[model samples]
Target: MSALIDRFNRRIEYVRLSVTDRCDLRCTYCMPKGFKDFSEPDEWMSFDEIERVIAAFGRLGVHRLRITGGEPLVRKDLPKLVNRLYHLPGIEDLSLSTNATRLSKNADSLYQAGISRINVSLDSLKPDRFKSLTGGKLEKVLEGLMAAKNAGFSPIKINMVVMRGVNDDEVESMVEFCIKHHFTLRFIETMPMGETGQSASSQYLNLQTVKKQLARRYELIPGMMPGGGPARYVRVAGTDLRIGFITPISQHFCETCNRVRLSVEGTLYLCLGQEDKMELRSLLRNGITDYELERTLRQAIDLKPERHEFNEEPSKVVRFMSKTGG
Candidate 1:
């Protein structure tokens, strides 16, 4: 009843769980301005329900759990959930992806509760541009990052989704920032997801351009992965901190896709770029047997796409990345 595998023989060992769709900030790339007002708080999964699902996934060979959201820290009692997941027997890695606005006050508590790693969404280094992109105060995010580090979260990962005209100029500066601060900086290629289709049209900066721009300043060195994750690391010429790239568009990793997602609404998404999902909530509420749940998981994995045709067009992406649980 605990078995889980896809047709490609990639074991489903990682699960990204969306705790809440509610976020304080209105990021231009992900959600529309003040979209939270339209969101119903009751639609989100309860902490207990999420824990039950994580336990089930853990039994089925899902050892790594990442908590994401419109912003995960937006959810109350997050450290309590982190502690629960931390003590789960089979769960080896418990991480979080957040905007870091709230972490300034909660980072210490989260670290104490045993959050293994953290990826902060910081799109721009400039305070004004940062405010424009995320409708958030940049000072808060920086403060959060500092707090996380001071609180003893090592090897912090910073995600900077690069758009051609927007913050591309800050690539080198980000590299320097990561290196100086000793954080693992990941420059992500903007995915074709967003309400406005800005992901497709707004100067889609690919990894090639990013690497070329970085090569001028730093000697890119191939890195070894201690664990199986998408970030292809390279040591900047003079610094010890490594910069990574998640080129889902340029360098597709579908063949080695070892992850699944649990949407905040309790749907299971096999792929991030696709909308076809299974309603786990229905089965859970209907008192579906564990065996039946196991069967349903296998069926979902079997139907997982070989690859996402992201390059097709903006219309091709069936769901936005925010809803897909990143």
Candidate 2:
């Protein structure tokens, strides 16, 4: 089968699957109040259900997959799920995105289970500031980072959500750490999301400003990050470190968007900054065949928007970034 191209002619080759929407942190940008209306135990798609959907995607030439969550590792025995997805025929790349709190304990097992790459979200390098920002101990995430490196995951990425005054002060510190450790660091602009809706509007920091600050100290050579996401990667001259800017707010990447999201409750979303979505869990539970599933997905992808009007309408999304599996 050929790849599915959207109305804009962008081929959809990746999918983000949110295994769970529950997190152990109270990151103000993602979940101000910690938890959400969690999907009931029965509401979450089963491993079998997820596999079928992934297989359907594979037939459509969508071979890359990334698992996400409020915290994906927080879900019980996540390596088992990883192992399952690893064996699927069409999955060329498999990864997980998390806060890395659980990575300390599960990194080794997760690596052995076929997850070779990971994206760990770390906002601040200062312990106190990090605690205040995410409501989690910074030491735990650091420990997880070490464990991940030792586990042999290549291109372990640090996703730092840069804000105006929140963690912007530590941008240099974050870059130094990544430079020292040979890790890829991506600075993401805050988007207006979550129930409180305070992070994006109040805390949004332009990446262009951050880039200027970086250019003063180190030479940032232009490049792209491997295992492609939205980030525009740049090489830090004379170092193994690479800096990435995911400017969803300041600069939208929707025109080149090549991914879709499947929430824990089985909903399929075409755009990250939009509220519209298609119900897939129900259709799966209703026993649709693989062929029918592929047809439905093609129809949805055909309607995928060329861009997300986040700046035009900041309140476009009220759901937390956690629920959306960003």
Candidate 3:
């Protein structure tokens, strides 16, 4: 087996493919009004094209694939794509990250189609607070979560991006909610994605403070979550539901990072926080052969940075999380 190592000396084994740039929710942190003008519908890659790219990467030792988007469920015929991805050789695991607003209707179809796991984004528990932060209805997302559980999606992961004074007060409440429902609660640190939405002036509740607060309420025990992305696993004492912290800004995990991202527009970003990317769309449209596509995959892997500079020089460059396939 050929192991693909980036410049960082970290072996790349995971790939996140964005199915679309379109999303229903207008989260303040994600985009601005009138973004439709800037977003072009023709930029999206077709399902067959994405499958070809996945096959190319599979040859390069990428076995784990996660489907993400502005909201993956918003894409039509997603289960078809899931079924296609599940059949790929060496694909040990296939998962998705969704906002879960429409999951109530889509969960059963997705689960039956062969997706192994799911991560739902829920920033606040309070309906009004959630509406304020997400610019949408909270009840819809709650129903989606319920539907996912009913569909028997094991290890349901809930992602909470805690911004100080935004949803920080709900940390303990979120933990209790997760324990009550047997879902993994993951806390993520907000990063400076771009200038369009919430910027660095917004206070981010550091992970240390979050851990200290959670420690006061629950006897937190360290643990591991299978098929990792960025979250550091922990189990709430006396409960089965796990809690995870993804400290990208305050404490970077670039050293252990093992994933590569492909934008829906067909740009393969080696780093989530950096703007450096390799365009695979041109080669695909030009009818590049599979063997040549594999070569391109290796070229992209070779260019992966040793680490990101967000910790020391966050202001040097900018790219939105939505655009970066976060």
Q: Could you say which candidate leads in lDDT? A: 2
TM-score of 1: 0.94
Higher-TM-score candidate of 1 and 3: 3
Off by over 4 Å in 2: 34-36, 198-200
lDDT of each candidate versus the true structure: 0.81, 0.87, 0.84
Q: Could you tell me the C-alpha RMSD of candidate 2 in Å?
A: 1.2
Q: Rank by lDDT, descending? A: 2, 3, 1
- Please give each candidate's TM-score: 0.94, 0.97, 0.96
In angstroms, give how far residue 297 of model 3 lies from its true place. Answer: 0.8
TM-score of 2: 0.97
Model 1: per-residue Cα lDDT over 1-326, one tens digit each: 55687787888898999887778787776777766443466766677767777887877888888889878887889899899989987899888899999999999999889896899999888999999898889999999999999998876999998888888889888988888888988888876676644543666778888888788877888875454468888887666878888998888888888888898888898887766678887677678876677777778878777777777654666455667676
Best by TM-score: 2
- Between candidates 1 and 3, name the one with more favorable lDDT: 3
The residue pairs in collision within model 2 are none
lDDT (10s digit) by residue, model 3, range 110-210: 99988878999999999888887778899999999999999999889999988888889899999989999999989988776676433743666788899
> Which regions of candidate 1 deviate over 4 angstroms?
37-39, 198-200
